[model samples]
Target: MPKSLHRRLLEKGWSEDEIERTMQMMYSDEKREKHAHFVSATHPVIYWVGLVVAIVGNLLVAVTLIPFLMILNSTQLYVILGIVGFVFGSMFNLIIKDIEHVDQTHHIVAGVFIPAIALITVYIMVSVANRFNEVINNPNPHNAIVLSAVYLITFSAPYFVYKIKDFVWERKQKASEGA
Candidate 1:
């Protein structure tokens, strides 16, 4: 049989009274739920927002690389944005009070998603900048608007994929349960 948590704690030098108190505090239903909600809400919000900012920062770098190589040195701007995003995204782990409660699948999804989005964003931005250098160089209202729309769609693709995966998984789980 697996050792009880309290037993493990005791083996690790936790006093009996301390373990009892900690268990009681941890097992309190209301407190646990509230903590879970706080973690779930804050972790993903910070992570996704940070990811978007980082991707935009990467796109800015890509823009500088292709068409704006001579005209714009936006490396500093992107660096700052990247740093901020990294700090914010890393807070997902820091803000989590209980590691055991974290969904492993979500962590895995983020691990894959962040790098994939970053690479894709850089590629798309560089390709667009190269092809549409004229529009970028001589910016007009219509062209700017169209470019922005394209960027919006490109940046949101990862999120759309995640949602689709989640939807499919949920449907499968429901079907399995029903059967």
Candidate 2:
């Protein structure tokens, strides 16, 4: 069975009165039910748009970095894989949200998806750039290795941003609860 409206609201951080009113509306109006269905269908369009933006951004980053990298012939492979992964992540996020029970796992799934795609994209682009830099100056493998490590750290930028946003929202929820 579907979860009760009260439970869904509590999970969503809605006020008690808001929950009651929503539940009442759900029961009393067929129109409200239709609207809910519409919202449910369209809500993740925003996420899809975000994913598309991410894909485009990652592709741009890749294209920009490719020419600059003077490194070994293998840099192209990694860059291509990075682009593919981001595209897959975007499409996966869009498709998964359409399936039933997606609401139960949406946030965690999205949280993981965004960072994974962002990290892979960043790593590939930075790796190529680092190799390119090293190839022009020193033929040393050590520079490439160091660049990889630094690039991995940079790849985590999105995760930190996501965590901060989540923390702020949680704090707001607690403050609202206290008031």
Candidate 3:
């Protein structure tokens, strides 16, 4: 833990990038200890309540939006659908943040979460777009263009979220194994 050893570790063929990685490892250790402390101090009911709330919120949003998409035959409705996708993705990210520990169980959860979310978002956007085009014989080319761009952005959300999730899970898995 001496300053000279830290400096030597960085200077002796170890680049600044490697030093930063080591620092990050140290930080994660601190974070893990803090999380364990928090979990020990808090009531089990709180964690369960938070988990239930996250699940229920995600479910309600999905269910309500599906029927809403079935009726969308207007540009306004497509816009609304885009907003819904954005908000739902954002909230799911927030919910995942509340999770204090990561493990193989979370690895499975993260693996399944992204594609499912992407599928739902794509389905809703396509459904809305098709319905809107049907209503107006002359489709707005710009609207279609914008919708496509939005859909691409929405598709990427799950990819990034799951990538981070997978990274966290791998780190936790390694740490747990004393690697």
Candidate 4:
């Protein structure tokens, strides 16, 4: 496929800002929707409710899933949690995305907050439930925190990958404009 005009201009060292200005002048009558999130709703309240439900769902999943699986095998418990985290993370990511311009503030906050709370609750529940087990007979917050990190990483991995891609794209656009 042929390179876009913007790409051609950039390759020839035209500043991104100039191309954007020129494009705007050429297509001044066109209207553009600023938000890129895939959610169909236009109201902010719907997104807030989705975010809240996703958080609750994540917590419910983690709270029940971890200890139940921990019984089957203590060694790979964190691994199992991480896998589950990844699934929940992806689902929550979609739920968190919506039509409210962009979740700039919520992205960093809610994105992590949902999974983190779930994992933390899992840690607490596990420690409490395994009070009789020799390994966790003396349950420690430090160990739970460490184990929770495994879940946290996998859960947020999918979401963060998209966020990182956006970040890099933004930086590239900024650098192109600067040049």
TM-score for predicted model 1 compared with the true structure: 0.38
RMSD of 3: 12.6
RMSD of each predicted structure: 10.7, 13.0, 12.6, 10.7
* TM-score winner, 2 or 3: 2
Q: Against the unseen true structure, what C-alpha lDDT does each candidate score?
A: 0.55, 0.58, 0.58, 0.69
TM-score of each: 0.38, 0.44, 0.39, 0.59
Best-fitting candidate, measured by TM-score?
A: 4
| Model 4, span 73-164: residue lDDT tens | 55567677778878888887676665224656755677667776777776776665565355665432225666677777888788778778
Q: 45-152, model 1: which lDDT tens digit per residue?
A: 665665566556555555554544224434542454344334434433232222314556655665556556655655465456545656657441123233333443
Q: Who is ahead in lDDT, 1 or 3? A: 3
Runs in model 1 deviating more than 4 A are 1-5, 12-18, 33-55, 67-157
**Can you give the lDDT of residue 67 in candidate 4?**
54
TM-score (C-alpha, index-matched) for candidate 4:
0.59
